[model samples]
Each structure stands twice: as structure tokens, then as C-alpha cells.
Target: MINAYATLASLVAFAQDRLKNEEKGATAVEYGLMVGLIAVVIIGVVATLGGQLAELFASVSEELPAVTTTTTTGG
Candidate 1:
């Protein structure tokens, strides 16, 4: 009836007010945005350094097998 409608309207209004008064979710949202931005920057830096890093690791890997074989034979 009318009372039920009134109660629902009041509940909706209360929920709207509570949402407007909320600050906890806003902080988490800001942190999420900051993390997303940082991730994008990291992705950009890694992308830029990708080729150089690959070559460096390749050279290390190539030398590592040789070093390991020499050490094993020497022992």
C-alpha cells in the first residue's frame, strides 16, 4: 500500500544519501588509478628497454653454459 511505497522511497533516498556521504570507496578508487598509471609507465619503460635487455640476457646465458662446463671439467 501507500506505507510500503513511502518506506521504499525513504530507503532509496537514504541509500542515495549514504552513497553521497561515502569516502572509503573513493580512496580505493584513487589508489587503483595510481597503480594503473604506474603499471602503464613500467610497461612503457620495459617496452623501450626490451631489445637491449634481451641481448644482455642472451649474452649472459651463452657465457653461463660455457662457464658451467669449464668448472665441472676442472673439478
Candidate 2:
């Protein structure tokens, strides 16, 4: 009976250690998935808005005045 109990305890301990390691790996995988999803969302938004944003900047630039600069040399 005592030997059986010892064997069971060792098995439980081994399983716990393995589960801890697996949890770490699972957490890393979850973070990677989240980053991938965020990247996809950013790409989609940029694709959807790129043309409209370019037109907006072009219109703004057309409305702005050009600047002239003069440089003087000092002795």
C-alpha cells in the first residue's frame, strides 16, 4: 500500500511540472496570436484609408502658400 501511494505521488508531481511548462508555452502562443491579429487590423485600416488620406493631404498642400527663404553670409 505504501509503495503504491509513493508511486502515485511521484506521478502527480511529474504531471504538475509538465503542466506548468505547457502553460508557459500556451501563454506565449496566445500573445503571438494577439500580435498577429493586431497587425492584420492595422493593415486593413491602412489599406482602406490610404487613398482618402492621400487626397486629403494633397488638397491641404494645394491650399497652403509656398515659402521663400533668403540666406545672408555674416563676416
Candidate 3:
């Protein structure tokens, strides 16, 4: 029973040491942060341009002439 407890303890300690030395999770977190920043920038750009585009289309529509139609029948 004592030997078994010692082995378990050693294994636990080894696992803790490995976890402390690992960098894979940190890199993934960095990548996630970069992607988040890119998304924020994209949202900002769209918000800035959306109003300008709407105004441009509104002006163009105002400049265009209105359409009218007349129908005539001959007997």
C-alpha cells in the first residue's frame, strides 16, 4: 500500500511539472486574442462606412427623375 501511494504521488508530481512547462495552450490563447482584435477592427470599419454608403445612395436616388406613365385607348 505504501509503494502504491508513492507511485501515485510521483505520477501526480510529474503531471504537474509537465503542465507547468507546456506552452501549447498559451499559443492558442494568443491566436484567439489576435482573431478577436481583427473582428473588432472589421466591425469598426463597417460601422464607419455604413452611414456614408447610405447617404451616397440617398443622394443618388434624389437626383434621379421620377417615373410617370400615361395610357391611351383608341376606338
Candidate 4:
């Protein structure tokens, strides 16, 4: 019917207006992109330095002294 068509058209127009006026959705998308970029940079840095960092830790561990534990009983 013609009435049904009119109702559908009005609904579509309302949806279009809401989409145009909305800003929160766009801001959330931008923040998500920034976080993804930061994660990628962190992963790249860790991958590049992983081997050197491991070697540095190994050298430091060699320079440290061993631990000795003693237990005493008292009555």
C-alpha cells in the first residue's frame, strides 16, 4: 500500500539523519586505529631487540653470585 511505502521512506530518512549527526562512533574508530598502530610498533621493537636483550641478561646473570641456604632448629 502507499501508506506502507511512506512509512518506510520516513524511517530511512530518520536513519540517514542520525548517521550524519553521530560523532561518537567516528571517534571510537579513530582511537581503535591508534591503539592498533601502537601495538604494532611495540611488537616490532621487541622482535628487533629480543636477541640482544636476552644476551645482556645472560651476561648479567653470570656476574651475579650463587645463593646459599642454611636451616637451623631451635627448642
lDDT digits (tens) for residues 1-75 of candidate 3 = 355456546655655675799734345654565566567656767787999989999987776543212222321
Candidate order, TM-score descending: 1, 4, 2, 3
Which pairs, if any, clash in model 1? none
Ranking by lDDT: 1, 2, 4, 3
The sequence of per-residue lDDT tens digits that candidate 2 reaches over residues 21-61 is 85543356545655665676677678889999999999877
Give TM per candidate.
0.64, 0.48, 0.38, 0.50
Output the better candidate (3/4) by lDDT. Answer: 4
Cα RMSD, each candidate: 16.7, 17.3, 19.4, 17.8
Which portions of model 2 miss their true places by more than 4 Å?
1-26, 66-75
Superposition error at 37 for model 4 (Å) = 0.5
Best model per TM-score: 1
Off by over 4 Å in 1: 1-26
C-alpha RMSD of candidate 3 = 19.4
Instruction: Give the range where candidate 1 is weakest over 10 consecutive residues by summed lDDT.
Output: 22-31
What is the C-alpha local distance difference test score of each model? 0.70, 0.62, 0.61, 0.61
Stretches of candidate 4 off by over 4 Å are 1-26, 66-75
Which candidate, 1 or 4, would have the higher TM-score against the true structure? 1
